[model samples]
Target: MIEIALGALITLCLLLTGTCLWLLTNQREHARWQVERDARDALRDQRIKELSKRLDAYLTGSVRMGEELQELRRIVAPLPDKLNQMEQRDPSSLSFTQAARLVGMGASVEDLTQSCGLTQAEAELVSKLHQAQRRKS
Candidate 1:
C-alpha cells in the first residue's frame, strides 16, 4: 500500500509539471504575437504620416501655381482696354503695315484685325511692313 501511494504521488507531480510547462510556452507565444502586432501598427502609422506630408506638399504647390496664373491674368487684363482706346482714337492712324508690326510684337492677329476693322489683305500688308521693319532693325 505504501508503494502504491508513492507511485500515485509521483505521477501527479509529473502531470502538474507538464501542465505548467505548457502554460508557460503558451504565454510566451502570446507575448511574441503581441510584439509583432505592435510593430506592424507602428510601421503602418509611419507610412500614413509620410503619405499625408506628401499630399500637403502637392496641395501647396498647386495653390502656388494657381496664384501665379491669377497674377499673370491680372497683369494682362488691361491690355485689351488699352488697345481698344488706341483703335478708337485712330482707325487709319496706324497703317496696316504698322498694325502688322504690332501683331508681330505679340498682339494676336484676330485682336488687331478686329480692333482696326482691317481686311485680311490689309492685315497681310501690315505683317509685310512689320517684317521689313524687323529687317531694318
Candidate 2:
C-alpha cells in the first residue's frame, strides 16, 4: 500500500507539471497573436492617415477648379450681349470683324477684298493689325 501511494503521488505531480506547461504555452501564443494584431492595426492606421491627406489635397484642388470655372462663367456671360451690340452698331464693323477673321486664317489682302468686300486699304490695315496682335502674343 505504501508503494502504491508513492507511485500515485508521482503520477499526479507529473500530470500537474504537464498541465502547467500547456497553460504557459497557451498564454504565450495569445500574447504573440495580440502583438501581431496590434502591429497590423498600427500599419492600417498609418495607411488611413496617408489616404486622408491625399483626399484632402484632391478636394482642395477640386474646389479651386470650381472657383476658377465660376469666374470664367461670369466673364463669359456678357459676351453674347456685347456681340449683339457690336452687330447693331455698325454694319461696316461686321465686315471688318469678318475681314479680321479671314486675315487671322491666313487670307491674303486680295482674298479679304474679294470675299469680305473690304477695300484694299482696309484689308492692308487689317492684315497689319493681325500681324501686330500675333507678335504681341
Candidate 3:
C-alpha cells in the first residue's frame, strides 16, 4: 500500500507540472500577440499624424492662394475705369494697336511698355506674335 501511494503522488506531480507548463506557454503566446497589436497601433497612429500634417499644409496653401486671388482682383478692379478715362482723353490713341504696330516695326518691349502703355508681358506677346507672323509670311 505505501508503494501504491508513492506511485500515485508521482503521477499527480507530473500532471501538475504539465498543467503549469501549458499555462505558461499560453500566457507567452498571448503576450506576443499583445505586443504585435500594440506595434501595429503605433504605426497606424504615426501615419495618421503625418497625413494630418500634410493636410494642414495643403489647407494653408489653399487659403494663401485664395487671399492672393482676392488681392489680384482688387488691383484689377480699377482697370476699366482707367481705360475709360484714357479713351475719353484721346479716342484716336488706341494703345494696344499702337503697341502692336511698334512691335511689328521692331520696337523694344520697354519702348512698347512706356510709349504705348502696354505691359511688358503684353509687349513680349505682341512681339512674339508679329515675329511668328513675319516668319510664316
Best by TM-score: 2
Q: List the candidate 1 regions with Cα displacement exceeding 4 Å.
A: 1-5, 93-137
Report the poorest 10 consecutive residues by lDDT, candidate 2.
87-96
Instruction: Please name the candidate that would achieve the greatest lDDT relative to the true structure.
Output: 2
What is the full ranking by lDDT, best candidate first? Answer: 2, 3, 1
In candidate 3, list every pair of residues with a backbone clash: none
List the candidates' TM-scores in order: 0.55, 0.65, 0.57
Could you give candidate 2's per-residue lDDT for residues 1-137 as a string of tens digits?
A: 99999999999999999999999999999999999999999999999999999999999999999999999999999998998788778765446778888889999999998887778999999999999999999
The collision pairs in model 1 are: 96-126, 97-126, 100-126
Candidate 3: tens digits of C-alpha lDDT, residues 30-71: 999999999999999999999999999999999999999999
Q: Rank by TM-score, descending?
A: 2, 3, 1
Q: Indicate the residue-level lDDT of 136 in model 2.
A: 100
Q: Which ten residues in a row have the lowest lDDT in candidate 1?
A: 90-99
CA lDDT scores, all candidates in order = 0.82, 0.92, 0.88
Note the residue pairs that clash in candidate 2. Answer: none
Please tell me which model should have the higher TM-score, number 1 or number 3. 3
Off by over 4 Å in 2: 93-137
